[model samples]
Target: MTPLAIAEHAPLFIVLNPASGRGEADNARRSIESACAQAGREHHIYQVDRHRRLQPCVQEAVERAKAVQGVVVAAGGDGTINAVAQATLGSGCAFGVLPQGTFNYFSRTHGIPTDTDEAMRVLLNEQPRAVQVGQVNDRVFLVNASLGLYAQLLEDREAYKAQFGRRRWVALWSALLTALRGHRPWYLHLSWHGVQRDIRTKTLFVANNALQLHQVGLPEADAPEQGQLAAIALKPLSTLSMLGLLVSGARGRLGEADSVVSFPFESMTVRPMRGHRRVKVATDGEIGWCAMPLEFRVSPEPLWLVRPAVAPELEATRQ
Candidate 1:
């Protein structure tokens, strides 16, 4: 269907996470409403009060708005977007983003405007486009799924942020430094695009698209468009080497590091060494401690999003 077709039929459901971006939902909602008024599109604002409650809210809202051609707009960061997108999969309800959360990785990758008014204008005026989604076991992720030290850092960062309001990167760095002191190599056995391989590494990331690793002065780019996943493995490095990798990443040359390896895959399964109890896993920026033996796969055509005009041309090229 054409962009105009989708807009004309769908009554937009804007889901705002008030806690995102340090409690900016009230301002975001007003701005969105103003944009809607200007565009003459009907919209309802729903605030997500809790993290796990998002799926049910999205499901119910989509069901209610189904007759009107529902489009669920996530007005927070990647976590909020991931939640709504996961629930709306295969439901024929297009997902839109307002990018109100910190480090909107999904929005940044897709070139969605971070500004509330600009994003709303794009949502009202842009076309709905299909994008691939990644699935690790039962959960859906729009950006990437990460395991190992980085994931642990994410878990810790969230906790620290809640307790102390420290910046996420600073918290992550502190956590990683602490975690690395006790870190051990993990065994990752997997098959990607029918090729079998094994690697023992300290960090493993399976990304739906390439991320401009912060502090690395590299041009930002999407993952390959073959609908395959990109995997990065980092061998255990000395504390100094790890810090150097961060520095190099900031300089945008992670591929140049001998400790980092990246490749493409269609799907894979990851398991930690035996007797490991709680390995960290993160989808988007949300982190959790999970048991070993997690299954991951690339879900073809799992989400439809409204793409802004300024978004990278590659998003428009997706089949």
Candidate 2:
């Protein structure tokens, strides 16, 4: 049951997302191949094209990998990892991450190496660890699931990035500003762990574990643990106050924002009071716009991950 024990018995299945991070899959594949050659380890690589194709690919990979230790390595961004995790959940297949993406939030959280060579080394040398994953409506996400203005911003950023190359921060900032100006509060009805609460919020974030935004202070103790979900709702604020809160959040001092409300829950539902445009949703870094109401929940069991050794140490500390 321990990480060390799991590492000794798992085989590696490297799944690469060819479209991730401006087409870095070829380079990553080379690195992985080189690493496997050097390490003299048995492995297989599966490159995924369309997003919808990930589920079937992962499912088949899981079945194939089950014979050789049941480990699946996601070689793209968080989106690739999320897709693979959804397939491997409860299948006894451990997941690994290569972190070739823009944000690489999951890698940062788990302390995976950023350097390609170093990441490959870690992949060959690391142990299989048990980490928590969030499940919403039978969907699995390893990092966090969120809604509100930020999700809308992600939508804009993704579109802009496709057309404008890598330097698209300006477009993202502009989209964020636009979202702030047009943002409106919506009523959220949530019930969890035998408690019920209502709130009007402009943004809702549900993380699988505490998230430290930009190295700012981490979430509070109320942050959901593995197999639990932590919910944070940003109450509507004046444009000025919201800007201030945004600045504070950027500085990782979100506790200073009076408009922020946070709690831990197992399940919850969010709905708009009146029919409006569909709400945007994001799990990890993938974005989609969905109509209200949205249902979110946590899986009963923890997902297995083949993470760097530092992941357990990082998880032990509350930042």
- TM-score for candidate 2, please give it: 0.85
Measured by lDDT, the strongest candidate is: 1
Over 107-197, each residue of candidate 2 has an lDDT whose tens digit, in order, gives: 7677787667787777676776777677666567777788777676766677777777534375547565655686776777776777777
Query: Against the true structure, whose TM-score is highest?
Result: 1
Per-candidate Cα lDDT values, in order, are 0.72, 0.70
Model 1 TM-score, 2 decimals: 0.87
Q: Report the Cα lDDT for residue 283, model 2.
A: 84
Predicted candidate 1 versus true structure: per-residue lDDT over 192-298, tens digit per residue: 66677678888788777644332232222344345767778888888888878877776667777888877766678775545675666899878866666777777
Worst 10 residues of 2 by lDDT: 213-222
In model 1, where do residues sit more than 4 Å from their true spots? 1-5, 50-52, 166-180, 211-224, 276-279, 289-292, 309-319
Alpha-carbon lDDT of model 1 = 0.72
